[model samples]
Target chain A: MTNATQLPVTLGLRLLRGPAGAVLVMATIFVVATLAFFAINGREAVSLFQEMVMGAFGDSYSFSETLVKTAPILLTALAVALPARLGLISVGGEGQLYLGALFGTGAVLAAVDQPGWILMPLMLAGAMAGGALWGVIPGLLKTRLGVNETISTLLLNYVGILLVSFVVHGPWKNPNSLGWPATIEFPAGAIMPQFFDTRVHMGLVFGIVAAIILHILVTRSRWGLGLQVSRSNPRVGATAGISYERNVLIVMAVGGLLAGLAGIAEASVIQNRLQDGLASGYGMTGFLVAWLAGQHFLRIIPLSVLMGGLLASADSLQLYAQLPKASADILQALLFIIVLAVASLWGRRRDI
Target chain B: MEYFATELLTLLFAALRSATPVLAVVLGEAMTQRSGVINLGVEGQMLLGAMTGFAVASVTGDPWLGVMAACFAGIALSMVHAILVLGCGANQIASGVAVLILGGGLSAYYGTPFVGDKIDTLGNLNHTFVSDIPLLGQFLGPITPTVLITLLAIPAISIFLFRTRTGLRWRSTGESQDITRNLGHNPVHYQLAAIAFGGLMSGFAGAALAVDYTANWVEGMTAGRGLVAVGLVIVARWNPWYALPAALLFGASEALNLKLQSWGVNISPYLLATLPYMIPLSVLMLSYRGLRASGGGMPAGLSVVFQSAR
Candidate 1:
């Protein structure tokens, strides 16, 4: 985005150029809109606003939960950002995460009697494969059959969610639980390793490392150049031997694999079981975070954390404010719209 | 044999009842697509409409008023899309997704109070009328008018698209904004009108679900039917005439699932639930060549959605 929002004449806007300006514009709009929305409804708008902030980062426990939420968002964001480098709009992170959990849990169930040393790797591998499978289907469909990736991914999400629902309610229901619709608890060996005695797991490391590695690869490597070229001009990239179709599958697979890790992490470290609602819309949040960061991998790290806090806080808001948790989606949408509008306005200025 | 015969008789009417919302949404989405603007927010618009329809109908006790309110809500929501995509020259896909998020969030937030609430006028299924045929007259009587309007809409929309001047203008704008501009007509105005019309139909569809039959307000009630409409528009190859059969395909799967569950069938409901979603995917895959060969199924504007048009 251009530095047009921060002009001396536009200094009336109170934000300087770059990321800070964008954030300022988005935050101001979101805050005012949210406050006005609640105030118009005759609620204690100011206190509710404070409750939202405190709910997000107020104390140690809240902060940890925020980090736990951050892990999945971070991983899923990477899953989306990677394919976006090749100009693929993938909204399948939710489905991929579910598939990852599905496959990862399958491994756990298959080798329920195995020890951790052997079981851990198997579960992770299975999860990755499952996520990759979900990603690859859409990628393959797009490259081979010319299906719209957005619609394909969205449809796959429903199928993936129901697939989990079908298994848990039918074949995989824990026999001892009687009527409860969920699988057996994961054995300790299969659980993702936690950090600092908190719910933050190995998935966090995977996400951070993946983001850095992707940043290096995308910005510093010839393969990354191929992605950029292929995104901007597939014909040109093909002439340069980039093989756009091959790259599409690779990026999509790797993206799905990362999201799969997040799925297994959620099942193992947080929920401790393969169950329905395993994703809880983190995949959607991840997709939003990826887009919010302009599909830049490194930037996705902080954005995911910030978005995680928003989601984490929303949970708290539901507890205290008597509001539904989906309220956070409104703020997220507002941020996206505001950022998009400002960025476009900046781009328009640059054109002149 | 008796049970099977009884199920078969009502299944057609049930499928038509269920298909109404999807068919309406498909027609609207097709109108938007035909005008060269892809409104992925149809799903969100439907949800907002469903919520508003339920909320207003329950409070006002007037289903028509609720439906009108729902339509306005949808139009207002789509205006957000128009502003972002047209005024800001933003990426249409991102803008559409943003609108979806906004609609979903707002509906969820505001519709919280209306959960599990039902309006008396909407529960048409509870007050059944007995008939000599058992299923034919009884099943088709109350919903026949609704069914007629929905079915009639197919030809009505088709005539608008293929036989009217404005319809030609909308299709031409979808094909080429530049050529439309050269022809001294503003593509923006045409696309905006098409989007608003799509939103109106989406709202009407949602209201049909809320006040016309179910009357029970549930959170996120449309449940991806709007997305199915997106695929149906493509599967129908952007032709409103084909939308009915395509919508019925989805509606039949859903109706069959409900039937099977009621009959205590051994099949997992979740597995059956996957059928409707699978139709568009399979159709999209199998009919790829047909879609492209028949003068390109996707609008030229939609093909370049990621890029800034301005």
Candidate 2:
């Protein structure tokens, strides 16, 4: 066949391959699981699903809310995707995000009298440092002590939250705010500026820029090539003079940096304070987004926005369908399970 | 000194009671890991079990039934894990996270109605014959049935692992799947069974927490106890016999934290609450070389399952 004629035929065959087939099956499974859950709850599945769709995409306000939510999700997803490239599993994004927010809040509180130009950069730097420190602990342990990064990161997540709780409940407790365990609010100057009269802030710009930068780094950089080699075969990579341990540390630091940026964005642009519920499963959701995008840095943007829309609709699920707030969690969980199953099946088929 | 002795005795009893649930979960994970699969879905499974146990106990007014429901719920969740990891050759770590999300979501979604609802909990066992025995009675007087079962499970699991033919088969499956397959034993089947059994124990642990330990239902009630149990398994070196002491140690830390808080210690309660998590991290780091030397008792076939597919 001619090159032009062969292209369409090959593309068609690829879609019929195992991975694509698995995706189709997973989509069906997600729909069925959603219906089953709604049925069990005694709600009409079709109507609730429709309401979810409308709630997420119905109006300009909802779209803006999704975009707002997407910024942090995108950043956190990058936190996961980067380390995953180096075959490291770092699920401590929740912890890293919290530490980032804590440090960001601390910087702003300390520099309340400073101008936005000076204070904002300091806050960002502090947040990134805090997250990097948290992330590096697991990386160091994994490389130096042979500690399992997965378990260590998971443990640190709880510890990080507890550390934050200790501060907010003790040293950082705002005397003016009645009884709620929270730090002082950021100075108005420290708050990030909104974009185009929408609630979406400068964080959205940061997320897009970061994603673009990471895409370039992953696709066009020597470090990225080294990372891939280490991930594929550590012994071979070592023979080829790639420093596997260094890659682990570097990837983890980069991952933490992204997650830290997410924390600063959420604290300054969204909540405007360091408080409990700051992480709120965003770290876990970011894992889902990264997995769904096959850990592709560029794909994280669209996938995060998609997940963000689903999360935004959760409020409407409570309002319109009378479902609990956890209804959204149920949907996300089902989608994640299906996607993982499909991906696994695809991997198996490729072996043949 | 006498007063201090009495306080220490009371703390020991509390630690024993608190350690029951962790004991169950760690033992279950030990069994799962022994069969060459790492199931990190324990936290999620425990949550689902806790919610289901509470709901069933309240609705049916039967604590035993609640325990059974929790077990089935755990098994159901673990089945998903098994299908993904064993059947489809999914990455065990990733599949585990997905299962955790599913379990957390399902429990939270369905648990809304049961929130704030109360039921007759499984209270302390009333063994009149044993309670009449002087000083020993004083020490064991407040023991609950679930705690007794957990204590019994330690020996039972140890015996099963070391003295049974099926146990050898399970161990071999984890050690070398190729050999097991050559011997006409399906390694995947053993892994599924182990995973299911693990789920059952996790369910019982959740039921114990809900119907025995706390006697209440709330969303995400298990907290991170399931994950803590996983760490405990590592500390115990995957031996159920060692798991008992490790679990008690964890329980002691928790009890000590509470005691300190009650005594109005100057430290932040949140910081003290972090002791359980921090201890495990420190233990892992300090014992890394020793653990590596011992191979952490991980099944040889277990680590390669994910890699081979990739």
Candidate 3:
């Protein structure tokens, strides 16, 4: 983390002098290699980049789709980002997402014929409540019980997935469909309304609004300051008589609420029904997104959107390049790693 | 009742089969954590190892070679983490996550052709005479090769960690770096060796998944078992020997879920499937609570880098 000029300068050896320089070098290498790969394969790297931009925000139609994708990542990123501020690594967002989605879908299904006003609020509540409940488990364990949040949260993810899969396969199975593992499709009224003629639903707007509120909560509020103190030096905060236990629970609950709302966004806005695919790696990617952004709540919006584009472009890589969707997945992961490595190095030098 | 009994027995066998990968990884994690390094990249290492093992075995048609390849790949990937944590003094969590990302991508890149392709398995090695005794036989009924190997590994690791002087040194390294340094033994060396051992064990776990459990490699085939192994390590109090029973318990839950599915049960399959996954989380939570303060089981100064002056 030494300053760039602290060490003797040699053109070839510059990257080794400081952490930031090394990260810059790594990022340069990654971008260069990726473009070179497309080039060697006889594809236009520029065109691909252009397509990605178009796919992410080119037309009104695709722009809305990007919004649909960004909602979950935005909220889930908050789920990780908030806890990260408490020095607690809550990797259980995936599990919380599964639980939230399941509960949200279950609520909608129960009130399937209810009016849009009643059903919408109920669904959002269910999603948030479910996610919050799931979040509290790890929080309590870490704060009160002294459990390592990393392992606890991770294990919960598997549980959440298995639980969701079970429900989709068994009781929630669409009775009319032969053996397709999915919930019954939502009635038209139950689906969230699109904001304009575009595909972006109201959930994208909800995500943006949520981000603003979260920014205030993290940066300006008393609880936000308390969170900063806890993360930076929990012992100091504890000595100051700030209840670490209570703060941990509150922060996690807030994280859970955001993540759960993300699940609702998926159900009502994107998929319009709960399916087995409802909890697709959004939670995990949200972690990467948040981590890459250094877990700034406000920063998550752009990062999520950018990541949303990367995900949106993945479908095209499959269609046009005849590459498995997993290849694009690899690229997304590689970009995340590059960002994390760089951010960590940069973070060491910058005081948060 | 008869059907239920048979189903339970069948699941017992399946549980034994399914538990191998988890057993191997948890055992490896137990060793690493004992010396105060928590390698969160266990999943990444296992995936790389499994993919490597599968690709190598498929190419060479030698199960032994595949096993060796898996071990080598696992050790190689773990060393990358060692360099970051032990050499550069990076955060263990961050380093582990980085290695995981790398392992996952590497596996996906190399595992393209082998995805869904079945391979020649090591096959079952059920000792008929030993397995024929009434109730005792039922316990040994579904002894796959991996299961047998894992069972043997438990006690052997226990003896190695407790009975040997090297084991004591390894324990001291994990317990306190200062004590080990005071004793004139390099803690980083012990940490590296422990991590290397972990890589081999987790690799074997990955290999078992490809060759025995599924007989085919899938993208991210090791799934979250590596994380569960880490959970199991903490839940078991870093006891290598205890990992077997813990893994079996997890395997049994999975076996139950599979059996119920096979029987066309009407219950939510997700809830049933959740049985195994919940165990580790619950265990981590409970253990974390029981241990209270005292930094739980993590090694002191685990994330710090060491530079010996020449």
Candidate 4:
């Protein structure tokens, strides 16, 4: 893709545009957009923007909620960026996430009596396998069958979501819930370990560690160099003894594995039950973050945190101001648009 | 035997109703992709249309106004895609995804008030002459205005694409910018127009779903149909004519799912819902080679767009 050789451009953007200017642009645009949006809706719109910030980081408790949302987004962004490094646009992170939860929940149910040591490993493995399975299908389809990875992965998303819905609504419905579509509440041993008695769990650690390792592998390793070679010119890479097919499958599977981890983490730690609408738009959010960071792994970390804060703030806006919960989504989309437009314009001016 | 035929005819009619929104999007997508622009954000655009259409219709009590509003909403979003992709040289896929998120977010935000709201949906034309006929007549009975327009859209788009000079030039942009440039036309103009057209059709689709077919409002009601239309457009080999069959196929699956629910069958509603997606997927897999070799390959520019990261 034309975006792979964009590191130099990204670096130029960061340096030439200046960090302060960039933040100001984001803040000004966000303020105008959100204020206008609320004003059009006939809301008071006064000081709502400041409340949004406070909602995300007003106190220790609010900040912890932001971190909670950040974990899944961070992992999913890495999932997208990995395949993106291979010049493959895989939008299947949402599906992979649902598969992870489905598989992880299944493991927990099967071993309801098991202790933490046995259950955690088994459940994590199951979730990873499920996510990997989703990723590998699209990879194999592209590699062997010459299908468009983008379209296939997208179509799989609906199927994956429904697959979970089918089970919870049918075979997996907790009998005690009396027609409510959900699995039984996860046992205590099955839950992800939280830190500092806060809702923030080990998923955040997993995401940060994964991002660091991915950055090292993608930017500093020989295998990562092979991925670049294959991405730029597969035939040339093949001549250099790099199997493009192998790299494609490897990136896709690993990407799916990471997303699956996010899914199970949400189910076990957050929802405490496998249910419908589990992790609804996180994958899309992650995909946007991956692109905004220009597919740079480490950069994805801060963007995910910022996005998480924005999302957390939206919940507060909904409760306090009676704004629709989708307000955050609008702001997020607007931010990406402003960023893209500015970057592209800057590059165009340089070209001229 | 006669009674069974009636059931089959009713199912066929139900299929077309379900196909209305998806079919509209497919026609527009076929044009957009032919012009070398891809709009994967159709899902979000449709949702916006659905919400706007439902909201406006419920307030104004006119489904026609709802349809127009939805169309404008779609065109508005598509313009955003065009500006980002064509003007600023943003990545087409990424810009599209952003638009999708934006459209989804905007629609969900706006549609929040209209959830569970109802409207007197656009009704079907029940000509007594058509109704008086046999099983097929009843199948043809109750054809809604949106379905008629969409049915006509199939041939209208087909003619516009295969018969018009402008359509040929639009397809040329997808093939090569140089060729289009040499032909004494700016490819960007074609792409911009095509994207707008796609957006307009997507809007009509959302209106059809909200005001014409279902006559109600529901969040995310278009489901994956926007994406489905995108896939089917490829399956149709970028030809609007083939969308008719694909639409019906989609309609059939949807109709079956609905009927199964009414029938209280043993199958899970969720699994039944999967049938619509799964069928298209199977067709996608089975037809990939045969369809590719049949010579209506993907737009040349689209493959390049996906490969070049920018």
Best by DockQ: 4
lDDT of 3 by residue, A86-117 (tens): 77777777888878888888888899889889
lDDT of 4 by residue, A1-352 (tens): 5576898888876775764466567668767877887788787676777788899999998899999999999999988999999899999999999999999999999998999999999889989998999999999877776677788888898999999999999898999988999999998999999998999998999999999999999889999999999988898899999999999899999999999999999999999999999989999999989988889999999999989998888887788878777877888899888888877876676678
What CAPRI class is candidate 1? Answer: medium
Candidate 3 interface RMSD after superposing interface residues:
6.9
Candidate 2, residues A214-260: lDDT per residue as tens digits?
88998899888888888888888889999889888888887888788
Q: What is the C-alpha RMSD of each candidate to the true structure, in Å?
A: 3.7, 2.5, 5.4, 4.6
Residues A274-319 of candidate 1 have per-residue lDDT tens digits of 8888867888789888988989888899888888898888888788
CAPRI grade, predicted model 3: acceptable
What are the chain A TM-scores for all the models, listed individually? Answer: 0.93, 0.93, 0.86, 0.93
Task: Tell me, by lDDT, which candidate is best.
Answer: 4
In candidate 3, which residue ranges exceed 4 Å CA deviation? Answer: A1-26, A33-64, A232-241, A343-352, B1-14, B127-142, B163-165, B259-266, B293-298, B301-310
iRMSD per prediction, in order: 3.4, 3.0, 6.9, 2.4
Model 4: residues with Cα > 4 Å off, grouped in runs: A1-24, A44-46, B1-4, B262-264, B291-295, B306-310
DockQ of candidate 2 compared with the true complex: 0.58
Question: Which of the predicted structures, 3 or 4, would earn the higher TM-score when compared with the native?
Answer: 4
Candidate DockQ scores, in order: 0.54, 0.58, 0.39, 0.62
- Model 4 — interface RMS deviation? 2.4
Clash-forming residue pairs, model 4? A1-B307, A1-B308, A1-B309, A2-B308, A2-B309, A2-B310, A3-B309, A3-B310
Q: What is the TM-score of chain B in candidate 2?
A: 0.95
lDDT of 2 at B1: 92
